[model samples]
Target: AYFKEKGKEVIYDAEHFFDGYKSNHAYAMRTLQAAAQGGADCLVLCDTNGGTFPFDIFKVVQEVKKNFGIKIGIHTHNDCGMAAANAIMAVEAGAGQVQGTYTGFGERCGNANLSTIIPNLQIKQHYICIPENQLVNLTKTARKISEIANVTLNERDPYVGNCAFAHKGGMHIDGVCKASSSFEHINPERVGNKRRFLMSEVSGRKTILDKIQEINPSVTKDS
Candidate 1:
């Protein structure tokens, strides 16, 4: 009402209102509809405490979209390890935008990792969320944001983490040697990430072969 009184657009950050606090989908739907009818430029659904599964999120988001024709957005937390999945499901259910902190950094577990969401949407689902050439800049963008916030980056964060594209297991490395798709669902290069080969006790000849091929493709596997 304040924004409307001022003749300005209202954007509500309704994250986590759905966690375990309100288990009623019907109520949620009604609330979102009312917000839209009241003149919200966009309706944002949040996985407030995280922990929401993809299937559940899909069901709720689909209903919201069906009931309200306004723009939908998703803000997910990383608790219970389903932030990325929930965000994706929201899109599938008709959400137009995704919001999250880079590298999933936030209060508790973390917010959705935009790095993972961007590539998954663009490469896997063929969503035009980001420009094709600019995709590679994702990692740099995440790191830059982390630097600005003065937060330490997680090495295991998806897509942009130091270890996101690293490989260690012999069998996994061998499969990647034949084809990166064998081990990685999406090409690391697509997200400005380079493939890594880690040698350890579990490393084998196949691992070595794959690493060699990755380094010098001219060398045949038989050699």
Candidate 2:
């Protein structure tokens, strides 16, 4: 009420919300009700410890959205390596907003990875979080953020990671050679990344044949 009277929009962050909800369901809800009464424009449920499971997040967020008429948001930490999953679950349960770090850096383990969450929502689920053209710069932005933070970009990070679309194994390379979709979830270029074919003994003959054929279209497997 104070903020609202002063012409301010308050986005209330319910810290340790999942933990509180698990420990005391009624009290946790009472706290949110109080925040609503106090004129919070949006209620952001936070998994402070990052210990909550995705299933629990989904269930609780669903309940919160069902009971409240206000806008809902989610903030999850990556302590359990489930932040992205938990955030996605919350969205599936009807939360309209998600909070995360661009490069997944934060206190302790880290925060939910926006790099992972955005693509998951936009490319796979058909949700639009940003301008379609901006989405293509995801990998570039992630790399830039990592550089500014002086942290080496995680090569295995989904969508923007170096190895996220790399293929090295023989069968895998063959499948990718036949059709990129055979081995990749989506085009790496979608996020401003690229396909990488690692040259190694284990890459198999089919991979070599594909490469040779790229230069010499008449090349045959028997030859």
Give the distance in Å from residue 80's predicted Cα in candidate 2 to where it truly belongs.
1.3
TM-score of every prediction relative to native: 0.82, 0.92
Candidate number with greatest TM-score = 2
Per-model lDDT: 0.81, 0.93
36-71 in candidate 2: lDDT tens per residue? 989899999999999999999999999999988999
Per residue, candidate 1 scores C-alpha lDDT tens digits across 64-154 of: 7787778888888888888988999999999998988768877788888888888889888999987899999887887888899898778
TM-score of 2: 0.92
Where model 2 places Cα greater than 4 Å from the true spot, the runs are: 206-223
Q: Candidate 1: lDDT over CA atoms?
A: 0.81
Clashing pairs in 2: 1-38
lDDT score at residue 70, model 1, on the 0-100 scale: 81
